[model samples]
Every structure is written in C-alpha cells, then in structure tokens.
Target: MLEKIFKLSENKTDVKTEVLAGITTFMTMAYILAVNPSILSAAGMDSGAVFTATALAAFVGTLLMAVLANYPFALAPGMGLNAYFAYTVVIGMGYSWEYALTAVFAEGIIFILLSVTNVREAIFNAIPKNLKSAVSVGIGLFIAFVGLQNAHIVMGGATLVELFSVDGYNKLNGVNATMNDVGITVLLAIIGILITGWLVVKNVKGNILWGILITWAIGIVCQFVGIYVPNAEVGCFSLLPDFSHGLSIPSIAPIFCKLQFKGIFTLDFVVILCAFLFVDLFDTIGTLVGVSSKAGMLDKEGKLPKIKGALLADALATTAGAVLGTSTTTTFVESASGVSEGGRTGLTAVTTAILFGLALFLSPIFLAIPSFATAPALIIVGLYMMTNITNIDFDDLSEAIPCYVCIIAMPFFYSISEGISMGIITYVVLNLLTGKAKEKKLSLLMYILAILFVLKYAFL
Candidate 1:
C-alpha cells in the first residue's frame, strides 16, 4: 500500500510507516500556524484577525500544496517575515494593519508573477549548491542557538566580558535577593530539553507526547509547590472566534479607503520593501531547492520538479495567508523529516492537511499546549536544519564566503531574510570582482535582487 501510494527511492514500507510519517510531519509543521500568529500578534494590530486569517488560510493553502504540489514540503507563514510584519510595519513604521496587509499582498503578487513566469527558479540557479547546503546547516546552528538562549543555558552576565549565568545568586546592587525565578526557569527548560532529547534519541515516533507528559508532570509538581504557569488567555480551553467580528479582507473592504502614499516613495520604504522582497524570494527559493534535493524531488535537470507549478502553490499559500492575516509565504525545513517516514506522495500532505483541519475543531485542546513546551520542539528541529550547512564546499571562495555569510548573519541578525539579503549581495559582488560573473548564469531577477541588496545595505 505504501509503495502504491508513495514512489520513494527506497523500497516499499507498510501503511503504518506512511501514517506515522505523515503524523510526524504534521506535528512538526503544525507549529507554524500557532507560532507565526503568536509572534505577529505582538504587533498589536490586526493580531486577532491576523491570527484567525493565518490559521484558516494557512490551513486551506497548505492543503492545496499537499494535494496539488504532491511533495512533503509544507507551506505557511515563514519565520523572518512575520517578525518584520509585526516590527517594521505595525510597530516601527506605524502603518495600519490594512496597509501592512497591502504590502504583503503586493509581495504576494510579485511572488505569483515570479512563479508563473518560472523566472524565480532561473534566478536561484546562480546559488552555489554548497551555499544551499550551508543554509541547512546554518539553520541548524540557528535553532540550537535559539534553544540555548530560550533555555537560559546561554545568558549574559556582569563581567566586563559577559558570561552564561547559571545558579548564581541574584545580586541586587550589593544586595542578595531571596527570590530565584531564573533558576526555576532554567530548571524547567532543562527538564523539557532532557525529556525531548530522550524521546528523539530513543526514536519515539511521537516525541511531542513526551512534551505533554513532562509538562503535565512539571505542572503537577509546581502546583504542589505553589508555583504555576497560567494559561491566562484561555483556562485550558481554546476560544473560537466570533466570525461576525472576525476580519476578512478577501471578503470585506477592510477600510482600505485611502492609500497612505506619503512614505511609499521614500528611500526608507523602498529599501525596506526591496530588502523584504529579496529576502522573501531567496529564502523561499533556497528552502524549496533544499527540501527538493533532500526529498528526492529533483527532476532530470537537477531542478525542482514542476518548479514553476510548485512556486505557484507557494504563492497562492502566501496570498491566502495575507488575506487571512499573516506574514509572507515560506517553505518549512521540517518537511525533510517526513521523507524518513516513507511519505513520498501527496497523500502524506493530505494526511497532514486533514489533521490541520481537524485541529480547527479541536482548537481548545491545542490552545492548552503552551508556547514554552513547543519551543523545545522548534529548538530540536532547528538542530536538524543545521545539517544542511555541512554540504558547503569550504575551499571555494564563491561558495564558502556566501555560505558563511548566510550562516553567521542569520543568527546574528536574528532574521533569515537579512541573512539571505546579505548573502545574495556577497554572491553578486564577489563573482563580479573575480570576473567569474560571466561564467555563471545570472538571471534578470538575480541582478535585480543583487542591486536591491546593494542599495538596501547602503541606505538601510
């Protein structure tokens, strides 16, 4: 049955394997719906709507990808872009939630154009394979870095040189405070990490089960000790949105009455928009290429299978997310894990999508799952993503420099787009300086992205 459904490179597997694989992929990718919205909600504009829209649209859009694109790759609102959507638009620039939505829509349009034209893939051809691999490894390092920071295992201290503070007394201006909240946080984080690692290393099919079990155990213990992590938003139950009050741009006008065109022409906006565009383009391109390579989805030409059509799926996913209220579209790195389960066909995606749809009905159960608990899973998955970095040819300047740039810059800048933007700029200029530019196939899109990066760095 697995062979009938899945055309895997490896030999056939049982239905049980496919089911388990699908479930694992779903679990890993499910966080995007919850997390992307959570972070974007911080912007305090259209958050409720954005959250709802992102969830609903991502559900529908991802299903489309799963069924139509027929790959293990999962699509949803991405990492770096959501932060920008929240920070740059609604917070820093003080744009209305509507305009931010418009900006996203604009980018979505660009993405659709690029995909339909097959121009996006052409541009990505210039990226060295090693750099592509480096992106994966760099993402892994990123995840580990995030995990350490979140676990408070890595912290800053008061030495002239900062240090990771562990179990140190709370020194308050020459005074010792009796309370020690940091220690407790550290302990909880460790407990979560240890339990998660144990399950993963043990090859437990459902590692998240361990998270729930440990979380409950910790909760019970803390309750006995008169300590608790409250579910303030919902008392262990998720709330459904009153659709009458819910915002929907695709359905409603959304008060997009007048264009706030004043700041639109400014260099700041131009740089930011272009910066965002390039970041969106490359990150999505890189992820698709990486997952395609790992999933054995590469075509005879060494290009992603049905490259243009796949981009369309991604584009529609992004647009759907925007109307539903999220950031840009992106491919999930966790999709690679699904391949391990023999999930070679679109059925894997269908399984995942059905689960996501079911989740909407069981939102209450999901809401009960806390963010800190999920962080451990993300931290681990991030570790897995780092594996791609090792493929970079460290000896080649063209590949090595760009690879390193992307690896370090992403975590340092705390944004994937920023890292990608830095990388493309490096690739273009380095190739040009060495007179090796003529040797590589540089698309019009690449040139434009290269130029965008140059001016963005210069002004932004």
Candidate 2:
C-alpha cells in the first residue's frame, strides 16, 4: 500500500528509511513547538492556545505537502514571519493581534490565487536574487536581535542597546534583579548558545532541539540547587511541567478562527499583507529549489517536477494556519535534514505529519520551555539563515549596495517591511541613476514595487 501511494521502490527508497528521515526532520524543527508560543504570546495571544495551534498547523500543513505535493518537505509556522507578526506588527505598529491575523489570512488567500494561476513563479523570478538573499540575511539579524532581547541579554541603554548587567537592567527598569533571577537566566542563555553552537559544529542531527531541552533541564537543576530562584515579579518561574492533569491537549478556543476584517481595506493593512506575501513566496521557492537540488529531484532545466503542487500546498497551509490562529505556515528549510537522510517520497512527509499530530499531547513539556532556553534556538537558526550572505555578488556595486542597505535596515529600523521597502527603492533608484537599469534589465514588477514603496514613505 505504501509503495503504491508513495512509489517507494520507484524512488529507490523503503519505508524504514523514509520514516527515519521524517523523524530526523521533525527533530530538527520541533523547536517551533516551544518557540512559536513564546513569540505569538507576546502579541497578546494565549500561549497554551498558540502551542496547540502551532502543532496543529504543522500537522495540517505537512500532511498537505504529502498529499498535494507528494514530497518529503514539512511545514510549520515560519520563524521570521512569526517575529514580524508579534513584534513588528502587533507590538511595534500598535495594531491589534486580530488585525495582524486578518492580514495574514488575506495574504494566504492571495498566495493561493497566485499559486494556482502560476503568477507566483513570475513574482518569485521578478525579485533580484541578491535582494532575496539580502532579505534572508536581514531577517537573520533581526530575529537574532529579538532572541538577545528576549533572554534579557540585551537591554535598552544610553547607546540604544547594551550588554546584560544586573545592576544596569535593574536601574533601567526600576526592578530588583539579582544573580538568581534575570541574571542567572541571561547567563544560562549565553551558555545555551555555546552548547547549541557546539552541537551544530559537531554535526548533531537534532542540535537545536537538544539545545532547548538541555538548557531547560539545566535551569530546572539550577532551581533545585537554589542557584536560580523563581521570581514571578521578574518573569522567572519554575522550569517544571505540570503533569498533574495526566497529559491532555490544550484548548485552541482562545485563538481559533479569530480573524478580524474590520480594517482590512486600509493602506497599512495592504502593506502588511504585501510583506507577508513577499516573504512567504520567496522563502518557499528558495527552500524548494535549494532542497530539491540537494536531493537531485530537479529536472534537467533545474526545475523541480511537481513544483506547482508543492507551491499550492504551501499556499493552502498558510491559509489554513491563519484560520488555525497561527502565523503563515510554509515549507521549513530544516526539511533539508530529511532530504539529506534520503527522504524522497511523500511517505517521509506523512511520517513527519504524524509526529506533529502526536506532539499535541506533549503540550506540557513544550509549554514549560522558557524563553531563555528557546532563545538559543532562535539565535542558532539566525546563524543558519545568515549563511546565505555568501551567495550575494558583492563585486557588483549596484547589487551590493542595495543588498547591503536591505541587510542593515532590517535590524536597525527594527522592521522587516521597512528593510524590504528601502531595499527596493534603493535598488531601482540607484540602478536608474547609474545607467545600470537597462543593462541589468530590471523587471517591470521591480519598478512598480519601487514606485509603491516610494509613495508609501512620502505619504504614510
């Protein structure tokens, strides 16, 4: 039955290998189970509910990838997109969480339309390759900065950002922080980064997942030894999961289908939707192409067979994830781990989906994971994304300048959309002025985006 469905022999694979590959993929990306709730809850969503939503979204999205695309890829609420949703849209822009969710829902619908009509490929090709890589690099810096802040390893200061110091943090926030409270967590976060980094360096299969769990365990040990104290006022609590309820799923009622369309037609909302669409489109395409290339799944022309199905699955997953009360769910780059393990058929994805479904019952362990522990995963993932910087052609002045602008603006301006907007505008204007516009053959879509972004800054 499995062979008939997934063509295991046709792909020169067996059930055992595929299942093991799926497990490998799941372990590589399971940090989302802990990190997504930590992020979305910052946007005022219920953390427990977000945990359930995140797992369910991963399950549905990965299953869709299996059935619709028949590929080994797995899906989850994307890392950078969730940060943009929580910190940038909800917190930075003063928009309500419902408003941000509405934008995500609208973006998903647009993605679905674009995917089915084949416009998504055109859009994907329209952007300059260097700029796309720059976007990824910029988001890397942005999210890493967020991780540092989350762990209180970085704080606001006279210089705008400063290293963590117990006295300084207490003075700045008017709170009493000792070595046992925020100080210890910050120290743990630092140690966690080293541990996670070492794991990555050693080629550990589930480095990030193990990093989070080990860090949390260390914190629990610290609490036991009285080196780390639970101070609720300082946002430090016991690092223990409550298994008193005997392991049950949390209710998703807090965030399920809670989309708001009251201000969907506004300009800001349109900007938000475009940002979501832009990121998801390129991220999915890049992951598909890169991973498929690694797996030797691409055809002679460097195109993956059944790419349309893969894209449609991603589109459907994003839409479904919004309805499930999470951020845009897209193909995870960690799927590369599975591919490297010989995951070639949908069987691998099916196995991965089943694991995500099973994860729903392990909410207690996931929910108990503290920000300090998960912060290391974010930082390490940021390091992974930042590695794309090697792909940018720095020798070309026109391309390099815009790419550099895009990369720095993200962390500096503290907004991904701002970085993208500035990058497009800079690219178009610089090329036109330097007489390189016609030479580079900038796409009409690029010009249109540049004009729109300029108007955005000039007016709003």
Cα displacement (Å) at residue 216, model 1 = 6.1
Error of 2 at 243 (Å): 1.8
Please write out the lDDT profile of model 2 over residues 247-300, one tens digit for every residue.
Answer: 899999989999998878777887788889898888999999999999999999
Q: What does the lDDT read for residue 368 in candidate 1?
A: 40
Error of 2 at 441 (Å): 1.2
TM-score of predicted structure 2: 0.99
lDDT of 1 by residue, 88-128 (tens): 55666667656666677667777888788877676556556
Residue 128, candidate 2: how far off, in angstroms? 0.5
